[model samples]
Target: MPEIKSVPLSRAAAPRPGSASRPSAASLRYAAPALLGYVAVRITGVAILLIAASATGKDGMHRLAGRWDSVWYQRIAEHGYGYEVRLPDGTFHSDLAFFPLLPALERGLSALIPPLGVAGAGLLVSWLASLAAAGGIFAVGARLYGRRAGVLLAVLWGAYPTAFVQSMAYTETLFTALAAWALYAVLTDRWITAGVLCVGAGLTRPVAAALIAAIGVTALWRLFTAWRAGEPLRTQLQMVVGACLAPLGWLSYIAFVAVREGHPFAYFDVQADWNNRIDGGAALAAFVVEQFGRNVFAGLGLCAAFAFLFWVLWLCVRQRPRQPLPVITYCVVVVVISLIGSGYFGSRPRLMMPAFPLLLPAAVALAGARRRTLPAVAVGVAALASGVYGAFTLLGSGPP
Candidate 1:
């Protein structure tokens, strides 16, 4: 079991091999390539996507950059949450459509390096979030599973085509970083810190509700276990605090939006306008059919969703490697809700972004892969192709 020493949130290092035995330089050196490989793939994926967009036309490419959400993030980065946009409907739309954390980070980074307005800030945030995410994944796999799993986790994340989403201004990287760290903290029994981080994550994206829900369940389970064992009253109290963390982000944002947008639920209404509504089977089917016909990346997006379902079942049955049940549960729930509850098919896969960490266990399993290097190469190539699919569409618009 990982040691539980009370430390400040900022002071807490990821649980190591033990309190005494730190990993060696050799271990660090061994991990470098796997980490670098994941990063390289993400960068290449972004470049390819940009090229594809440039070659084709800006319309599709703009969508790839997430004009819908990214533009809001950009708007937020440019101007903090003001909550009043004159919508096509003529009534005001809430800035609450964009959460606070990403813009907060963008503004912070811009203040630090003025040259990095929103785009630069987004890029820097993505890179840092990616690195933090890799670290959290490594810490989770290594501490809970093993060192090999950690290396594989890093490689898998770096090599993921979805990493391209991070390459642009997408909020996945930031949310993942926060979620991973928060998960790590939860596992380590740092409940208050976990709650705070979860709150940050909630502010980053609504999907973070999954992470928060998972952590809340896990914390409750632990509290129950403690009560059964008669551990202590204080531990249970921490559970209460931790349970409160994740919702703070969303609630605060909603409150802010209510003040600015007239209706507290205005964000959801705006989402409906952009095709992000909650509906059942028929609505989702329409989206899937449309996205399948729209482009190749969309098709890959569908394939990955199904692939995740099959793979998760295999993980649950075969290895049953214990880490966070909530992690898997969170993923399954988010995926189902997004796919089914979501009104837009084109948005399903993108909405399924939180499942990115599920790739860690698969990567770990691949540690013993027969052709390890090839999987890396294969994934890298696929990412480049999928990401750049729009670049070809973007460039035909009369630009170099």
Candidate 2:
């Protein structure tokens, strides 16, 4: 066994070992760069993408600012989600698909300050959420690897081109923030708190199934290990309670959707009516091919979607080849479930955004690699360029 050296903030580090209640040098040293770098990178990416999109016209822009997703999100912010009459289908599609949490948060914050309007409130929430999430990511990384790797991981995700999604009226920032806190809680064995945060995350986005699944796996591992080591049953029981909280809300929603129709998976049926459901893997595969066949850029986006998933799996394999069973299980399952499920491939990038944290260590390691730096920089530039182009095309193309 490796000797555990005493860290500087012994008293403060007790139990969880890291908390804002008492300041510690290690905490600030690691968390500061991560926070600052995220802010700088996001501002820079948005600016660069904005400028490039302006220069390139529609093709270039679609790759940049993104499309009506942001607009629909804002609409939900202004007007609550409700079913609007279309044509044939009597089934209601809640503009509610946008979800209520982000807008509700924005409105709540804006009401607190007299001067801040809905827009200002929304920005404030995203801004704070982004910073806090990066901090949480830093804590996780630092604990798992080292301070350098942790900070680098946080910065990598913080500066990612798609981070603009966090800054917008979307729920990515909220979801990321909740997931980070939940992960931090799990790592520290704050089971109840972790479950609470996961519940919040699940409400933010259905994808939180990944977090719950991961936590459950981790808890089960703990239970098995405890039994093998001849530990008490109470500890294992508590872990079970902690892991179960993460999925309660999601399950309830699915049940509600099912009750609304004749069956539980009826949500998929309604979703299909929106041109948003998948017939099967064959349908999705054929659709993806058709999309890529549409144009050079569409093909590029498709490639990016696949690459993003691969990136997460690749990092998980390399860095945590033998990670806590729960973390690996949750991440792999979520990515697979998402890939196989129905939805437009274009949504995949955003859907897969939570996987951003996986990019950190690799980026950090690459940062130290004097030779690999150039190629890394080139790939980032290309990604930024595509995001910019995508944004413009999105505005012109209207809703998907």
Candidate 3:
């Protein structure tokens, strides 16, 4: 019980006897291959986008940074919300549906350096956030596994099917950066930092619910064992207070929406306007079935989509790399929300982007591959595929 209390409840799993400790500068230096691999993938993605855009006579930069959700965020930053678009079907989509932190950062940075502009600032935020997220992922993986596994984890995250979103003027990268660091803080027992980052993540995206739940559960576990562990009063108070702080950003946003829209549940109603609701994967399951029946190939593709998800999940559980409770909880919640949420079936992969823990098993496998060249080759092939897909998606249709 004392040992259990000492290990973070955020990661309720038992710690390995020789789990690597916190990452240091030297560890980061050793992560060069991972960092370089990520950069190479990003470059490939961007290069493909540029080439496709040129062939079509469109501005590549604008397409990547100024369309879809990016436009909505820029509008929010430039005009301070209160915007709405009523679809032909009569559903009103409100800018309030978008969270605030990304736009707020865009607004501030664009103001500080006028040349950067809103879109440019957004891209800057995303690029920087991607690096931060990578570092955090590497740190977490290194601590739990080893430097090799850590590096591979970061690289795999960069090669994710929706990795292109990390380069866009979107909130995904920003939210992921906050989440990775917040989880790291939890693992390291930095309760205050974890709470603060969770707050920021809450402000950036609706999925902050998962993060808050993780923090709250961990805090509760800590409190339950405080006496057995002989925890000092100060530490217990900090743990409780930090947990309390986790939900304020999300609640504050909800309250603001209520006040602004003249209804206590206006935020939820607005989400319904976009068909974004928790349907317990019923909608997702139906979507898969429908797709499968439409065209055999398309159906197979859809099946493959879910198959990939389950495969990663199976690996994570099978590897069971001595993760803490918070990491496990965060990973499960993100997967649930991503898969079970209604509408935006195309966006589900992007939504699952922050569930970095799923990569741990794959990373472990890659790290143990007898032939070092095989991992590099695998990453290269994946990057090429990802780049082509990202370019096609951005150049061909409605924002990715």
Candidate 4:
């Protein structure tokens, strides 16, 4: 595979016998540039948002941190669940459809810091999680490819069109952070860490179902191989334990919803209320084709969007032909769930943010650039475009 090679966890953890016992400083040195680059992109996006808000007499900070899904999360934090808003058209918006982990963290932090409201707490968590995400991305890239590729990987993830969500008081950053680290753990064969992070990711978003599936499939496959190879019973048992634990958080949430709503499948039913369900991309295709009838320009835009996603998926397959089973499974499942599930059309880009594996090919290209200036210019242009899009999306009518 041209993507990167996977290194085991113990090899990564252990230093040469005569070397320093830890690589903390080395990691920081490698990660600092990527984190700074990402934050710079986010700051530019915020600055654009601020200018746009000022010109329109709007509160950009509030819009950035308190509107749309941010508002939903804060509502869940401040006032528990069971809240619903009935639209004039008779459709209902219920808080129950949202996941709970991010809100729970917001609520806890808000209490810990009396001066910081739930929104502020949420932002705090989001920013920190974004940094952690960058680090995890770096770790994965470094282990798979090299440190340079790792740096590019982190920067590329931050340059995503929906990168602003990493800065907002949303669950994307937190979920991505957990998912990246969980994937890293899997790569390193840290079964316990992978299982725990998978649980956390599962708690943060329904998309975590994809992560759980990846972990389960990988663990079970490894367990069977270990059994056939006559590996130690303890070694096989760890895989079983990790796979078993991966889905608990998601299942627990469903049980809670079922109990609260007095139905066995109330969680799925609640999602149906919001027009979110798995329809094998029927709704997505309809959404794209309708754009042509309503507005040819938008139809072109949708075409470009679809083309871009298809290209990324193609790169994922073609560029990394020999990717580790966990990486391939995780990335493919993430794309499948993101595209196949029925949800708000506008939010699809944001939904795709967690599929960080899609960036691997781009990262490899950037990492392999002969002239340093080329990658720099590419990332710079991407960051600028990301900033403009983010500002426009946050300031526009609909939610991002």
Candidate 3 stretches with Cα past 4 Å from truth are: 1-32, 227-234
Per-residue alpha-carbon lDDT of candidate 2 for residues 312-379, written as tens digits (9 for 90 to 100): 58766554532334445656766665676567655655666676555644655654556645534744
Pairs in steric clash, model 4: 5-144
Model 3: how far residue 341 lies from native, Å: 1.4
How well does each candidate superpose onto the true structure, as a TM-score?
A: 0.78, 0.77, 0.91, 0.91
Cα lDDT listed for each candidate? 0.64, 0.63, 0.82, 0.81
Q: Which of 1 and 4 is ahead in TM-score?
A: 4
lDDT for model 1: 0.64
lDDT of 2: 0.63
Q: Which candidate leads the pack in lDDT?
A: 3
Q: Model 3, range 237-337, lDDT digits (tens) per residue? A: 87777788899889999999999989999999999898998888988888878887888898898888679889878666544435666777788889988
Over 204-271, each residue of candidate 1 has an lDDT whose tens digit, in order, gives 88787788787877767766766787889685787688878767987787676666668868667766
Q: Model 4, residue 151: what's the lDDT?
A: 81
Using TM-score as the measure, name the better of candidate 2 and candidate 4.
4
- For candidate 2, the 10 contiguous residues with the lowest summed lDDT are 4-13
Residue 297 shift from truth in candidate 4, angstroms: 6.2
Error of 4 at 355 (Å): 0.5
